[model samples]
Each structure stands twice: as C-alpha cells, then as structure tokens.
Target: MKKKIVLAYSGGLDTSVLLSWIKETYDAEVIAFCANIGQDDELKGLNAKAKKTGALKIYVDDLQEEFAKDFIFPMMQAGAIYEGQYFLGTSIARPLIAKRMVEIAKAEGATAIGHGATGKGNDQVRFELTTAALAPDLEIIAPWRDERFRTQFPGRAEMIAYCEEKKIPIQASAKKPFSMDRNLLHISYEAGILEDPWFNAGDVKYRDYFTTLSVFPEDAPDKAEYVVLDFDKGNCVAVNSKPMNPLQVMKALNKLGGKHGVGRVDMVENRFVGMKSRGVYETPGGAILHFAHRQIESLTMDREVMHLRDSLIPEYAKLVYNGFWYAPERLALQALVTESQKNVSGTVRVKLYKGGIHAAGRQSQFSLYNPHIATMEADPTKAYNQDDATGFIHLNGLRLRVNSQVNGPANIGG
Candidate 1:
C-alpha cells in the first residue's frame, strides 16, 4: 500500500506545484486539505484544482465560525499582539489550520502531514509545532526544506516555468512583487519587493496593489464615522447596537473600518525562525475590536488586575507568535486572561477618521470610574477625603526621603 500524506494545500502557485510534486516524488497518494477561515473567493474552485494537481481527495472545511469564536476571540481577550504592533493574524491562524489538518490526517490514516511553508519562514515552525503538540507520531514533510526541491525550483521564475511545463494552472507570475496570506481577520503581505525594508509601499504605483482591505489614509473620505461595539466578557458581541455573532460582528466592523482606512500596519518584526522580516498588514476589523475591547476593559477591569495582565502581554504575545498555542504556558496565561475578563461587558463608541481610531465613549454596568470622587469641583457627596492626602503623601515618600539623605542628596546634576 502506498503511503498517505495529507498536504495543507491552498491551491496557489507553490501548493499547486507541491501537490503534484509530492505525489510523483514520494510515490504516495496526496490528500489536500484547505481550511476556509475567511479566505473569501480564494476557496472557490479549489476542489477541481486539487484533483487536477494530483490530490486523491480534497477536504474543504468551512471553519469561519470556529475560527472567529474559538481562535480569534480568545486571543483578543488575552490582547495578544506580536511585537506590540502586529495583531498576530497569520500566527494565530496556523495552529487552527494544523489542528484541523491533523484530525483529517488521522481520519484518513495518513502517515504524514505536509505543508508548503518555506524553511526560512515562521509558518514552518507554526505548522510543525502544532502537529507535534497534537500528534507527535506523525511525520511532517516540508518540501521547501528538501535539497532536491530547492535545487529544482530555487526561485519564483523556476516555479512558474515548472508550472508551465507541467501544464498546471497558476495565478502567480514572476512580475508579482509580493506574497499574501489572508483570513477573516486580516490580509498580510510580505517577501518579494517587501524584502527591501526601505521600500515605500505608499508610492503611487505600489499603493493600490499592496492594500486590499483598506483604502490609504490619504484617500479615505473626509467624514469621520462612529461605531459602537458591544462586548460580553471581552468578546465583541454586537456592532452599532445590533446583536451579532462573532462572524457577523467581524464582517460588519471590517466593512466600517475598511471605509475609514482603520487598520494598516507596516513593521519589521523578529520571526520565530530567528530572522527579522518586514510585514504589511491590513486588519481593519481587528484594529477596531482591539481598541474597543481595551476601552471597555479600562472601564470595568480592576487596576491591579489590568496591570498584571498588561505586564504579561509581551510574554503572551510571544507564545502566540512563536507557535506555542497548544503549549501549557499559553494555556495558563489564557486562564488568567479569562478571569480578568469576567466583568468586561460593555459598549465602546469610537470615531474613525482617515486610518485613525479614537475613543468616543465607553460605559459598563460594572464600571469602576467614579465621577464624584474624581471631580475637580467641590465634592458635594464628600466621596473622597482631601485632607488625608498629606499623611498619605508623606508616608509614601518616606523611602525616597531616607534614600536622598543617605545618598547625599542623590548628586543633583552629574
């Protein structure tokens, strides 16, 4: 019996060729799996393409709802943003893809799982680490890491030529300047022309080609738009007072945010593979949700709890970025995040104008913000005692005073 390998196939130029190559090179039956996690029209015609490219069978799973509720929501609750800028759109999607792929592999009795992620990229780590965490016994086949595969198709030109020779239908051309990975959350662009860190994507010629979900800030409408997001325990549940599921909420926010050019991030980040890579992302809906979630959190979450969770943001971001979604450390951090979000139900109104998001208002039934105590005017209710601050200040400053005297006034102007 021939070995069975389940390949994560996207029906793209690389995977199109990979699907055929894996079948020929390994002398195995290749089963292609494509998870539909808000890829839009990219999922169309994948079945025909996969079979033509030599996949014995194809699994096109509609995981949009699951991806939004199960994966995206939890990460948002933890506020996991890679390197303080990236929303970790691509990073978060990998584990879910791999988890489903593993299930398909087991069900099909496949001995190995394969992916087209290059050895130099983080997806390679994300894909394999997920497989390792879930099914340690399954072999992982990465074609890009193989010397033979690299030798045969070292560049895009070679891959395009090979596709021509094989009569394989591909949408890629050598002239294409970059690669893109898209999901319901965002669309990320990298590599190719983007490899040049100084390349200005804002240049007139490249601007339209690079940006998909949003219009450039300069091109957005002059009018500012207001959006209200309702959250329950840190998960966005409605938009503009209309109750919606996670998937529906994302769709509505993406449309509103896209109109105002809300989420566009361009940054150089350290990949899990130990390299700094430039990535451009358009996460319109995600940006809005993150901002609104934080706004509500400020109103409802306790200061100490918020501070503790804020301190763990970097570590939590690192775990998600490095493909440790199923790791125990991430799970523990998630538990704390979940507990912190118990009272984080509220509505936040934000104003969007030319790619900028501004908090308009926020309110929660569990709000800790006391207007009476914080007022600068006379406290009619005497909610706060003002005369006690003298003792409070002196006591808190005792250590500073002692250190200054002992250290000879701390050397005023070195």
Candidate 2:
C-alpha cells in the first residue's frame, strides 16, 4: 500500500503542480484538504479540480462560524492589531487551518502533510509551527523549501509548463503580477507592483480590477450609514436590532461596511521572516466590529484595566503575527484578555462613511460612566466636591514646586 500524504491544497497553480510532484517524487497517495473559512465562491468546484490534478480525495470543511467565534472574537477582545494597523486577518486564520489539517491527517492515518506556502513568506512559519505544536511526529513537506522542488521548477513558467504536461487544468491564462489571500474577514493583495513601497496601491487601474469587498472611499455614497451593534461579553451578537449568529453578523456588517468603503489599508509591514512587504487590504466587517468594540469598552471597562491591556496590545499582536498562536505565552496572555471582557456587554451605534467609522453612541447596563459624578453642572454637595481639587492639585504638584524652589528656577531666556 502506498503511503498517504495529506496536502493543504488550494487548487491554485502552485498547489496544483505540487500535487503531481508529491505523487511522482515520493510515490505517495495524495489526499487534498481545503478549509472553507468563508472564502465565498473560491471553494466552488475545488473537489473536481483536485481530483483532476491527481488527488485521491478532497476534504472541504466549512469553518466559517468557528473562524469567527473562536479566532476572530478572541483577537478582537485582546485588541491585537499588528503594528497598530493590520487586524491580523491572515495571521489569525493559519492556526485554525493547521489544527484542522492535523486532525484530518490523524483520521486518515497519513504520516506526512504538505502545503504550498513559499519559503519567503510568513504562511510557511504559521503552518509549520502549528503543525509542530499539534503533531510533531508527522512529517511536514514544504515544497518551496525543498531543494529538489526548487531545482525542478524555479519560476512560474516552469510551474505552468509542468501543469500543462501533466494535464492539470489551470484557472488563469497567465500568472498574475500580484498575489492575494482571501477569507471571511478580509482580502489581502501584495507582491509584484506592491513590492515597490512607493507604488500607489489604490491607483484607479488596480482599484477597479482588484476590489471585490469595497468601493474606493471617494466612490462611496455621499450620505453616511448608521449601524447599531450589540455585544455580549465583547462578541458582537446583533446588528441593527436583529440578533445574528457570528457568521451572519459578519456577513451583515460586510454588506453595510462594503457599501460605505469602511475598511481599506495600505502599509509596508514587517513580516515575521525579517522582511518588510507592502500590501493592501480590505476588511470591511472587521473595521465595523473594531470601532464598535472600542466604543463599548470605553463605557464598561475600568480605566486602569484598559490602560494595562492597551500596553500589552503590541505584544499580543506580535504573537499572532509571528505564528505563536499555540504557544504557552500567547495562551497565558489571552487569559488576561478574556478576563478583561467580563463586563464588555453593550450596544454601540456607529456612523459609517467614506473610509471611516465613528462611534455615534454607546451604552451598557453595566456601564461605569456615572453621569452625576462626571457632569459639569455642579451641586455644592455633589459626590465630587470642587473644593477637594485645591488640595489634590497641591499634593500632586508638590514635587514640581519643591524642585523649582531647590533649583531656584532656571534662566527664562537661555
């Protein structure tokens, strides 16, 4: 019996070539696996394509709800944004995909697994690390890093020729200048023209051809759209007063946000592989959730707790970005993040317009915003006495006063 190897196949040119190469090189039976984490129509006819490319069988798992509830919500609650911009859309999905890959490999009694991730990118690290963490004994076949594989097909022309000779059906006439990774949360575009940091990623030529989730901000409607999101313990439960499941909530938000051009970002980010890459991303639903989450946090979260969590945002974001999702340190950090969400239940009304979302209103039953104490209109006997500030100010500034007296005030016009 031939050894069975599970391949994380995408039915793309690279993976299509890889499927045939794995079979020919190792004399192994290849079982293709595609995780359907809400890529919409991307998975359509994937099984047929895999079989045509010599796959023994194909496994397409619908992971939309799990992606949203397990991965996205936790990251959102942690406020993990890589480099203060990216929502870590691609970063957060890898571990879940690898976890499922491991499960399938075990069930099928496969000793080896393969992925089409390139050696230069972060996906290779994310996939391999998660696999190592979950099932270290299983062999990981990374074709991009394989010397034989590199020698056989050094470029796209060779890859395409190999596919043609093997009778593998490819979807495109020619290789695209750019690359993309799309999931429920976002669509990311990078490489080729985008590799040039000064390139205008949103130029009209690329904008019309590439944009699927959103219009350009300038092309969005003149009027703003209002959306009300309801949260229970930091996870959005409803939109516009209609209760929805995690996937439905995202779909609803995506529709509204897409129309308003709510999420678009272009940045040159530092990859975990020690290289900077410029990419453009559209994260319409995620943008809405981020804005709404902050609005609720402001009302319900304690000030000091928020500050402490804010301080850890960069570290937490780094872990996800660096493929440490399954590491002990990330798990421990996430515990603190989960604890901070106990009272983050509320409704946030958001105003969405061209490329922006503003929290118009927010309220919670467990709100810490006390009106009487915060109000400017004062009663002499209110909880916060105005006279108390005189002593408070003097006490707080005593060090400054003493320093001035001791130094005899430095020269004013030096």
Candidate 3:
C-alpha cells in the first residue's frame, strides 16, 4: 500500500510534469485538485489532462463565488494595493487555493502535498507559507526547489522534453516572454520580454497585451455613468440601494468597468526576493470598488482615522505580497483598519466613462460633514470665533518671532 499525496494541479506544463515526478520520487498515490476561480472556459478537459498525467483522482472545485466573496472582496474593502499599482491578483489567490489543498489532503488522509510553483517566483512563498499555517504536519514536495529534480531539468525546454518523453499532452512548451495568471479579479503578466523596463507599452511586440478603449460597450455612448456603492463596517453591500452578494457585486462591476477600460497598470515593483520586476495588470472590477470605497470613507471616517488607515496601506500590501495573509501582524492591522470603518456606512456615487472613473457624489447617515461649521457665510452667532485665530497664530509663531528678533541685525542686513 502506497502513501497518498494531494497535489495542486493546474493542468499546465509544470504541474503535469510534477505529477509524474512526485510519483516516481516518493512512490505515492497522487490526487489532483484544481480550484476553478472564474477561469471562464480554461477549465475544459482538465480532468482528462490530469488523469492522463498519472493522477489517480481529480477534484475540480467551483471556487469562483468563494474566491470573490472570501478573498477579493475583503481586500477591496480595505482598498488594498501593492505599491500603488498591483491589485495583488495572483498574490491574493494563493491562500484560497492552499486552503483547499489542505482540506483535500486531510480528507484523502494524504501525508504529503505537492505544488508546481517555481523557485524564482512569489507564488512559491505564497503557497508553502499557507500550507505551513494550515497543516504543518503534512509534508510539502516542491520539485523546483529540489536540486536533484532541478538538475534533471535546466529550463522550460528540458521540462517540455521530459513531458514529451512521458507522452504528456501539453499546451505550450517554450516559455512565452511574459508569464500570466488569469482569474476573475485580474490578469497579471511578468518576466520574460517584459523584463526590459524601457519597452513602450504600445510596442508592436506587446501591443496585444495592452487594453484599449475602442472596444467599449455601445450603451456607454462615450459618457460617464454614475452608480452608488454602499459600505458597512468595511464591506460593500449595495449598489444604488439594491442589495448584492459580494461575488455578484464584483461580476456586475467588472462588466461595467471593463467596457470603459478602467483599471490597467504597468509598473516595476520590488519583489520580496530582492529583485525588481516589471508587470502589467488589468483590474476592471477592483478599480470601481476602490474608488467607491474611498469616497464613502471620506464622508464618514474621521480625519485622523483615515490617515491612520491610509498609513498602513503600504505595510498591508507588503504582507499580502510576501504571503502573510494568515499572519498575526496582518490580522491585527485588519482588525484596526476594519474597526475604523464602523461608522463608514454610506453610499458613494461614481461616474465611469471611457478610461476615466471618479467619484461624483457621496452621502451617509453617519456623515461628519457639518454644513454650519464649514460654511463661509457670515453669522453673528458663530460657532467658530474669528478672534481665536489671532491668538492661535501668535502663540504658535512666538518662538519663530523671538529667534528672528535676536538674530535680525546680524543676519538680516548681511
């Protein structure tokens, strides 16, 4: 009787080879688990492919709703962005996939879990860290990191040759310059030809990678459309007074924002492994949600609270990017940031048009915008005394004035 292992199978080049390699290396029965998180039509023929690659059983879980509801929505609610650009699309999906892997491992009573993540990338960190957090007892087999496994394969060419020798059906063998991982929240491209930061986005070689505005929906009619987003305690619940599930809301927004070319970014970001990498991303749904969330925060969140929350965006982004989604520090920040949104119940209306999205109107029952205190009109019974400014300015400027007077004759004329 052989020990069993649950493998995170993508039905791609790496995982297909990994399945056979792990079986031969450990002599274990391998069950393949592929989580379907809005991959659209790419899920086709995955079961057959996995089985043909020496997998005993395949689990194709429909995790689209769960991915959006559990992972994407909370990150959006916090307005989380990595280095002011990345939507953390690939970074965010790792934990959800790893969680499922642990569940399947426990059910199958598997002693080991395997993944296809490479040694040079962030996904390796994200995947293994989540496994360590969830099921530390389960053994992890990462062939890319193993010298013995890597010695047999030098690069993609060797990987493809190995697959061919094993009669494994594959998509593309030679590595495309840009590696991409696509799901509901976004599509991310990195490495390969994109390593050159000077290459213009409009360059003919990478033109197809760019998103253009010519394909906007006809109903948009080259004009801005306004919609309201309702938030309660950091979660967006309604759009224009209509209630919605988190996944439904994201799907609706993606359709609306995609047609208008919203949320496209190209930037060079620092990776946790001490390398700077250039990546392009498309995040249609997340853009709309981010704009809407900030608008509601402006209306209800206190000034210092907003600053404090904004101050942690970089650190929060760092944690998520480095695969600390389940870490204590991230959880603590999440609690404080989310707690500040207790009074952030509101509706923020945003106008979205061809490649342009902005907040237009915002209102909330808990709004702190005081018309009387903020008004410019003259009133005899003023809540704010005008004379207070004279004393306040003098008191604050006293030290400066004294210093200047003492040094005036020597420094001023000279």
Candidate 4:
C-alpha cells in the first residue's frame, strides 16, 4: 500500500502543483486539507479542485468561529500588535490551520504532512513549528525547501508548465503585482510591488487592487457612524445592542467599519525569518475591537495592572508573530492575559469615520472610574481635602529637593 501524506492545501497554484509533485516523487497517496477561516467564496469549489489535482480525499473545516473566538480574542486581550501597527492577521491564522491539518493527518494515519509554504517566508516556520509542538514524529514535507522539488521546478514558469502538462488547474495569472493572504480577521497584501519600501501602496490604482475590507479613507462617507460594542471578560459579545456570537460580532463590525474606511494599515515589519517585509493590511473589525477593548479596560482595569500588561505587549505579540503560539512561553503569557480580563466586561460606544475609530464612551458594572471623586466641584465638607496636596507634593518632591540642596541651587543650572 502507498504511504498516505496529508497536505495543507489551499487549491492555489503552489499547492496544486505540490499535490501532483508529492504523488510522483514519493509514490504516496495525498489527502488535501483546507481550513475555512472565513475566506468566503474562496473555498467554494476547493474539494473538486483538489480531487482534480490528484487528492485522494479532501477535508474542509469551517473554523471561523474558532478563529475569531479562540485565536483572535486571546490576541486582542493580550493587546498583541506586531511593531505597534500590524494586528498579526496572517500570523495568527496559520497555527490554527496547521493544528487542524495535524489533526486530520493523525486521523487519516498519514505517514507525512505536506505544506506549500516557501522556504523564505514566515508561514513555513509557523506551520513546521506547530507540527513540531504537536506531532514531532510525523515527517514534514516542505516542497519549496526540498532539493528535488527545487531542482525539478526552478521557477514559477516551470511549475506552471508542469501543472499544465499534468492537466492540473491553476489560478495564477501572469505574475501578480503583489501577494495576498485573507482570513476572517483581515486581508494582507505583501511582496512584489510592495517589496520596495518607498512604493506608495495607497496610490489610487494600487489601493483599489489590494483593498478588500475597507475603502480608501477619502472615499469613506462624509458623516461619522456610531456603534456600541459590549464586552464580556474582554471578548466582544454584542454590537449596537444586539447580542451576537463571536463570528457574528466580527462580521457586523466589519460591515460598519469597512463603510467608514476604518482599519487600514501599511508598515514595514520585521519577519520572524530575519527580513524586513512591507505589508498593507485591512483589518476593519479588528481595529474597532482593539480600540473598544482598550476603552473598556480604562474603566475597569487597575492602573498598575494595565501598565504591566502594556509592558508585556511587545513580548506577547512577538510570540504570535514568530510562530510560537503553542510554545510554553506563550501559554504562560496567555494565562496572565486571561486573568487580566476578568473584570473587562463593559459597553463601549465608538465613533467611526474615515480611516479612524475613536472610543466615544465606555461604561462597566465593575468600573473603577469614580466620577464623584474626580469631579472639579468642591465639596463644602472637604471630601477630598485640597489642603492634603501640600504635604503630598512635598513628600513626592523630597528627592529633587535633596539633590538641589546637595548640589547647591546655583550649581543646579550646570
């Protein structure tokens, strides 16, 4: 009996060609698995395409809810944003896809797991590291890194020719100006024309080509849109007073945010693979959620706790971006993040307009914001005692006063 190999398939040109190559090279039966992370119509005919390309069986799992609730929510709670710009859209989705692929591989009793990620990109690391953490014994077949595969198909033209000769269908047209990766959270465009740091990705023609979830800022409506989001323990549970599941909340936000041109980001980011890559992202819903989550935190979270979490954002974001989602360090960090969200339940009203989302107002049952104490109006009974500030200020400034005395007031100018 031929060995069975489970493949992480997308029905794209690379995976299509890879399906045939794996069969021919290893003399193995190929089972293609496609994880449906809300890519809409992209997976419509994926099964037929995979079978036509020589997959003996195909698995398409609808993981949109899991993607939003499990992956996206936790990252949001942790405030994980790569380099202060990227929301880690493509990076966050890979581990889930890889985890599902590994599950299918085990169920099918496959001897090997295969993926179409190239040698130089971050996806390869994400996929392989996930497998290593989950099933280290299973052989990982990465065609782009395989010497035999590289030698046989030197470039994309040769690969396309091979696909044509083998009667396999391909979706790639002439070299695209940029590459795209889309999931429920966002759509990202990178490489090709975007490889040049100075390239204006927002040029009318290019922006239209790459944008999926949002319009250009200038094209957004003249009037602002107000939407209210409800959070339960840091996860958004409702929008505009209507309760929704995780996926529903994200979808509704996407519609509203896209109309307002909310969540468009362009940046040069450092890839885990040791390269600085330029990327443009449209994360309409995610941007709103992040903003609202922060707003809610301001009312409910303790100031010192918020500051500590803020300090850890870079590390938490790094783990997700670097393909360490299943690593012990990330798991430990998530434990702390989860604990921090215990009192983050609240409603946040957001004002959305061209390329911006602002937290208009926020309220929570556990709110630490005591307006009475914060009010400017003085209490005749001296509730806060303004006279107390004199001693408080003197105590806080003792170090400065001591330093000035020791150095002498005249020498302080030096």
The best candidate in terms of lDDT: 1
Error of 2 at 294 (Å): 0.2
lDDT of 2 by residue, 214-250 (tens): 8888888999989999999989999999999888988
Query: Which 10 successive residues of model 2 have the least lDDT summed?
Result: 201-210
| Model 1 lDDT tens row, 1-414 | 999999999999989989888998999999999999988989999999898778999999999899899989999998878888999999999999999999999999999999999988999999999999999999999999999999998877888888888888887644667889999999999988899999987665776776688888888899999999999999999899999999898889889899888889999999888889999999999999999999999999999999999999999999989999999999999999999999999899999999999999999999999888889988888878999999999999999999988886766685
**Considering TM-score, which of the candidate structures 1 and 2 is the better prediction for this target?**
1
lDDT agreement of model 4 with the native = 0.91
Q: For candidate 4, lDDT tens digit of each residue in 118-165? A: 888999999989999999988999999999999998988998899889
Q: Tell me the tens digit of each residue's lDDT in model 3 across 1-414.
A: 898999988888888888989988989899999989877777899999988999999999999889888888778767789988898988999999999999999998898888888777888889888989899898988999999899988788888889889999897645676777778888777777778898765444554565532222332357677878888876788877789888888877777788877777779998887788898777788888888888888889899988988898889888889999988998898888768888988788888886578878888899999777777887545878889999999999998889889876335553
Q: Return the lDDT, model 1, position 85.
A: 99
Residues forming the 10-long window of minimal summed lDDT in candidate 4: 405-414
Number of the candidate with higher TM-score, 2 or 3: 2
How many residue pairs clash in all the candidates, one count each? 0, 0, 0, 0
**Candidate 2 positional error at 1, Å:** 3.6
Q: All candidates' TM-scores?
A: 0.97, 0.95, 0.90, 0.95
- Candidate order by decreasing TM-score: 1, 2, 4, 3
Candidate 2 lDDT (Cα, 0 to 1)? 0.90
